[model samples]
Target: MPESFHKPVRRPSSMFDTIFGGHDPADTARVAHSTAHALLSRVREDPEAEVVERLVAFTAEHGIDTIASLWSQAPARSLPGALWRIYLLQLMVHEDANTSSIIYERGRHELASADPIVAGAPTPAGPDEMVALADAILRGVFDGDFAVALNRAASFSRVEASGATHLADDYELTEPERSTALTTKALRLSTFAADLDAAAAHWRAGTLT
Candidate 1:
């Protein structure tokens, strides 16, 4: 009789494959890119789009971890970078709609006497409007000029940060320091947005090495 033997079992390719079935980094990237592209296309095509919540839900349920995992290591001008930015924008708007609205309202009021406004950005008044503006901005990032979108977002963030600082200074309310702290974050985000804009510009100029 032939010696009884067991065929060797194949090991999983990666931890991801071991846990979530067999998918490698390339598969994850492809899925992330395709998922983002498809969802983004759906959002763009809807004339009366109200898909921000849906997009947020879908990303959280399906792709956030995978995309974020790879996104952290991607170069600024790469597809993963773009997808990460889009996901972040959506998640920010979704998770902090209330804070964004507060910041927007306070900033708008503080700037009212000076006619301060983001030139092309919408003046969002509440959570819904904030979500809408964010969606539109992300849409522009994909469908139009990426740099312009980044700059527009940066302008909005600057205005909001300015307003946040003004509120922190101008008011004597309970938790006055909150606005001050938020101002710091808003300003940091503004800088990041500006940096992204510069990167996009460099990419366009073919000088971004």
Candidate 2:
């Protein structure tokens, strides 16, 4: 497993305080969903390069927990949920590009699908390329076709899940515990892939929210 996955998630004290300080759950959900839609609208309506860049870099500067707090609880097919998944995917790559690239490489070889192409990753994507690919996918959400971006994320997740499963098999014989952990990770990634793919379909059908 990547060291980044072991790192403790940092939740800002102020945000937790606000969440626990009498803020209603319904109100929080409303704000989260509305804010997600509003942010997407703002970028789509006026997608200046500078504005897109700033939004793309928001989680990098503020930490994933900031947006995770707001949107993590949203329904999987909703706008906020889709946005949260995309940010989470980007964080995974940015935090541990090396492991991501290795797993992706394995999946590229094992999986007999067009996922690698849909994911828009370079052939033999290295750590640096993986990071760039993650950023590009997030940038596409703000500046390019939203459905396409979601599809790309879905494909990426699927490929990684496939890779993780195969790696688990490789470790099953000698390292049972590691194999079990990889299997669990693969299952989680598979779920994310399904949700992201559904979200993409919803977006294309004009019902993402």
Candidate 3:
């Protein structure tokens, strides 16, 4: 066969395959990844960003204190970047805290693992889902769901502990600057689940060595 005539093989798309490419979709790792994406999407999004409600109503709801206050002019490290870090970390906590959830985030890192906020890369929050979440929060707030917004705000407050201090009017993480690599504090289980679960699922499927 001519070298130019070779055709590429088509691969099947499973939840794992789509989320963690080259891995078998049936593995637990993928399950974790899927769950992480789904759960985080809910909590991070403004409408469903109920980090506490889900954690409390669901399971293992800790670290709700870490979230930074979005409405506060108290001076955060930076603006949008700070928001991203807090939410991303919360997602990790959510994945890890789940016992039945196969998601694992050890040695492995999630999106906030390496801080490249300056690259201005688009985040899940910037997407339509988050937009909707935010919209829902706004609508709900007017509809007398202030308590709901407050709860979501509470769940991610611990993220502020990640260090988003204000230099001037804008937000900034004064202590540990966000870069390609960030030195995080004692990590929460919710912050490390999805990645670990994805790895385990891959191993379970026997796709990875």
Count of backbone collisions within predicted model 2: 0
Kindly indicate the candidate among 2 and 3 with the higher lDDT. Answer: 2
Clashing pairs in 1: none
TM-score of each: 0.58, 0.88, 0.21
What digit string (tens of lDDT, one per residue) describes model 2 on residues 93-146? 877789889889998899999999999999999998998898899999999999
Name the lDDT value of residue 182 in candidate 2: 77
lDDT ranking from best to worst?
Answer: 2, 1, 3
In candidate 3, what are the lDDT values of residues 11-112, reduced to their tens digit? Answer: 223101122232443453344344444543454464443544444322123222222222111112222212323343333333333310111111112325
Task: Say which candidate scores most in TM-score.
Answer: 2
Clashes of each: 0, 0, 38
Question: What is the lDDT of every predicted structure here?
Answer: 0.55, 0.83, 0.29
Full ranking by TM-score: 2, 1, 3
Write one digit per residue (lDDT tens) for candidate 1, span 45-78: 6624345444434443554455555453344454
The reply for model 2, stretches above 4 Å from the true place, is 1-23
- Candidate 3: where is the Cα deviation over 4 Å? 1-126, 156-177, 180-209
